[model samples]
Target chain A: MASIVRKPKDLIAGVLFLAVGIGALVLLREYDMGRASRMGPGYVPAVISGMLLFFAAILIFRSFRGPQEVLAAIPLQAPLAVIAGVLLFALLLRPAGLVVAIIPMVLLGMFSISRTGLLSAMLTAAILSAGSVLIFVYTLGQPIPVLGYWFKG
Target chain B: MIELLGNLQIGFATAVSLNSLFYCFVGCLLGTLIGVLPGLGPAATIAMLLPITFGLDPASSVIMLAGIFYGAQYGGSTTAILVNIPGEASSVVTAIDGYQMARQGQAGLALSTAAIGSFFAGTVATLIIALMAPVLAAAALTFNAPEYFALMVLGLVVSVVLAHGSLIKALAMICLGMLLGLIGTDVTSGTERLTFGSNELADGLDIVAVAIGLYGVGEVIANLNAPAEQRTAAGKAITGLLPSRADMRRIWAPILRGTGIGSLLGVLPGAGALLSSFVAYAVEKKISRHPHRFGHGAIEGVASPEAANNAGSQTSFIPMLTLGLPSNVIMALMIGALTIQGIQPGPEMITNQPQLFWGLIVSMWVGNLILIILNLPLIGLWVKLLTIPYRYLFPAILVFCCIGAFTLGNSVFDVYVMIAFGVLGYLLKYLDCEPAPFILGFVLAPMIEEYLRRSMLLARGDPTIFISRPLSAVLLTLAALAILAVALPAVRKTRDEALVEE
Candidate 1:
């Protein structure tokens, strides 16, 4: 038996939109929705959410009727590695500081490439960390510290 | 005529100063450097470079940013011609005939043609901006909230109309962007709308963070997911740096036509540079004596689109400068730069910050001339840069993205925000959804809401005020007509055909 949803991408997008719209409405539920002439904080958002929901419903309906179109396979490794590297940088920047943060970030980020050897990646990370410290910290004087609580203490 | 000359004088005086000139050179150098890289588009390049301009004066920063823009346009073409890799979307068509020219050992000629054509187009486009911007600003000064609201609607719809993706998907992206944009505290009521109990969300997402994540990081991931190929320069020795007289004579008319088409199309909202080149190439092919020569080292193919993209990119600054409404993502970044400098972009900027306005316009011409020199004489330098491997490049770009986001308000929260959006952007790409309209919507959302609220207040909540005002009515009518036009099957098919070449 054929499934009702012919276009899985559209269905996913529609559901995403649905969640965002309903979530926005839920969040803004407590805010005042004053009359149109004197709109409160929630008024414009309420209107936007309604429109989003309407569009979401249409997308959901259309997904079922449209010719079957398969979504492309989403690559997980590269994006995840890159994102994890960024998350590490974010987590480390304040506590471990810029120098400590950048090396691991660059090293983890280089893992996205399948061919990169660990030695080269480590070298690249060290060079990048030093160069960034020179440019961003020494030359530009960005507010980030070189060493944070971990090293300072 | 007198006013034009006087404005030009102010522009030249400001642009010629040692301060602005130095930054302009730096900007063009950096823009060219990054734009030569295969995976780095102008948007990502600009986003990553935004942090560097934080300390400079508004005029200097703007001048440098504008230089980066057109300089990137120039560099993208160099990559397109020599390596057959378009560094940016606007250079996609240039690769068609440009790479062929390189293969035929006319690499230098092709590079020179693109540079010369772009310089010519840039000069003309700067002149157009100088003449037209003031008049537009004067007219926009009279626009009330309702008219502004209608204009934004027109811009959003026209952007979707020009988008190459599915109409429904683009519209959905617009809605999504607007919702994300509304996350901060409401300006009127001083109430937090969608902060989700987080202090980081109170200020809303920084434009720089969103831009870097969506374009810089998302693009890196996209490039990494694809099969990597090694790129080599087509010709070892690039001879014929100058076009022959016969070649010059053949290209002059196409350059003029391309500049004309690009200047006209660029003033419209959407991806003007990308559209201008596509349309210019199609027009050139249509009018050519030997249309069959287009993809096989046709100099006209190289000249017209190059001129069109440059002209289109320059003229697209019109709305951003005069109306303070960014027509594209690059303009949005420029607006972000202006905002950081405490300079609000609007019609008032013409009278209030004449130096910044005129200086930027003149700096573009200066920057264009610099690009020609840098691109033609130093062509070998850029071609050498194309050899940098993606493995090394992607990590460096990620580092920049992380630092760029961190520099935004000195907040690691912004870095986290960038990561979240980066993931969302990657997922959205899998659904075949473009991020351009989404970015535009994000930039325009607060303005749209502000205008809507003010218009409603003025009209005592009557939505009919949108149609009652003559100017607003006309703008809304155009928006409606544009939506209808794109929805029609015939027009949709033609749009598909026009964009399919890229």
Candidate 2:
């Protein structure tokens, strides 16, 4: 293993937990932690954050000694694209509406796959947009708008 | 016995109505559809389906939702047996022996064994619920804040016992869940605790977004990260759909044992089908004449867990329906659906809304029967579904989840929450951390805080009230024992070896 990165699994989990614990401690720093009899919003959280640090410490300690399971770095392309695609849809849904918003989302998702032909990707995008309109807009009567403000009344 | 039959008769009358039946059919079909899909779990499905329940009457909505829960259990085993992947958490055990059975060309027998075993278990569990709920509900009536607090404490400890791997990590995860649950405005103080001034934070995190992001989106990411060679093809092609005569005889005992274990544990508020299936698998392996056959296509492996999980799914409802405390995320969604209809789902359900209660109970049996028909004959359709590439499949699920989150409050902020958790879920998977305990922790955290406050108020700030009461004392003792037992090195080592990851 490289000197810079040791046990990734335990290391990552420990770091994650530590950050959460410390962050929570800071966030609840000012809230009134009432007595045990009548606890405030911060009481249970403070106690939990303390325990989080305890467990996170053990995990970080174990990283130096325990055997490794996953040493390889995680692949990032799929998740980033997928999450970004969904975010884009959410961003565009109200302003551009389902019909226009869905196109970019489907196109971005298909682009991540990288094997499908460009024409079919567009074809699939068109099909998905129509299906979304049919199911969510026409049949289910879900409150989503079909067209953007430019097209609608 | 006569009273049980009489109540069932009323249930039958209410459930057999056209509206209830239609919704039951929809729930079962939708459950199976999502179950066969690799990334979506029943909890996510139910959470995503929450908006649909807004318009329906309480009885029909619940009946359908209950059908979806068990129906998903049945569908999950199908994927486990065919492909090596488990479709849900409880089906993780089923994959070990089930995939082996399929590889050995007994895929048909494995699927049929699962179908028959699940049907048998579901029918019996439904009967158990009918017999036990009223009396159990009556007992629950006497429970107070101290008793409830103790019970939740026991529930959390039991959750630790059920989790695989390190007990410390499980405890930590539960604690983290409670911390997250504490976000949003404090109901008592009228002050926002973790909401950093955002109006969206006022009501706390949207649960459906969190659940789907963790289970649905996290699963897709994990599948993507899996080595290509390990993704293994679904076992050849399904052949005959019936087990050998001797096979049936051998399975009956394991099925019965599984049902007993499931029904017993499922009634516990925090434990559910996931716990039952694991215990059943371990017990079957322990008692088997050939324990080595476990990962090598043992029919008993498939039979026991399939039965146990379906039974666990049914009995898990007992605590939820009776106490209004959800045993799992799915039931939590059921509570969400009911609360949307202006009904607080607790002990009063049986006494005040008998139609909704009884109809839901009866609809479960009908749902099982419908599942049997769907699995046995429609096996080919599911096989067709199995061939769809993950590339095409995952994006659709992602899009649906986005829509589902948005529909909850028609807000973009909830969509952001789902994405954030989706990334968090992947990080946990990288650490070999299991999401099951985290989920249980998340669901129970809000209630734990509420109960602790009330109990303390009643006791006039004396913490001893928890131990001074008889029932609470007993429950707390069990929780303590659970912790102490796991702290033992020998027990911890054995548990790490026993658990199977999905």
**Candidate 1 residue spans exceeding 4 A from truth:** A1-3
lDDT of 2 by residue, B245-299 (tens): 8998989999999999888877765546887889999999999999998999999
TM-score of each: 0.98, 0.93
Q: Would you list the clashing residue pairs of candidate 1?
A: none
RMSD of each: 1.4, 2.5
Query: Evaluated with TM-score, which candidate comes out highest?
Result: 1
Best by DockQ: 1
Cα displacement (angstroms), candidate 1, residue B412, comes to 0.8
lDDT of 1 by residue, B119-170 (tens): 8999999999999999999999999999999999999999999989788889
Q: What are the TM values for chain B, all candidates?
A: 0.98, 0.94
Indicate the residue-level lDDT of A116 in model 2. Answer: 72
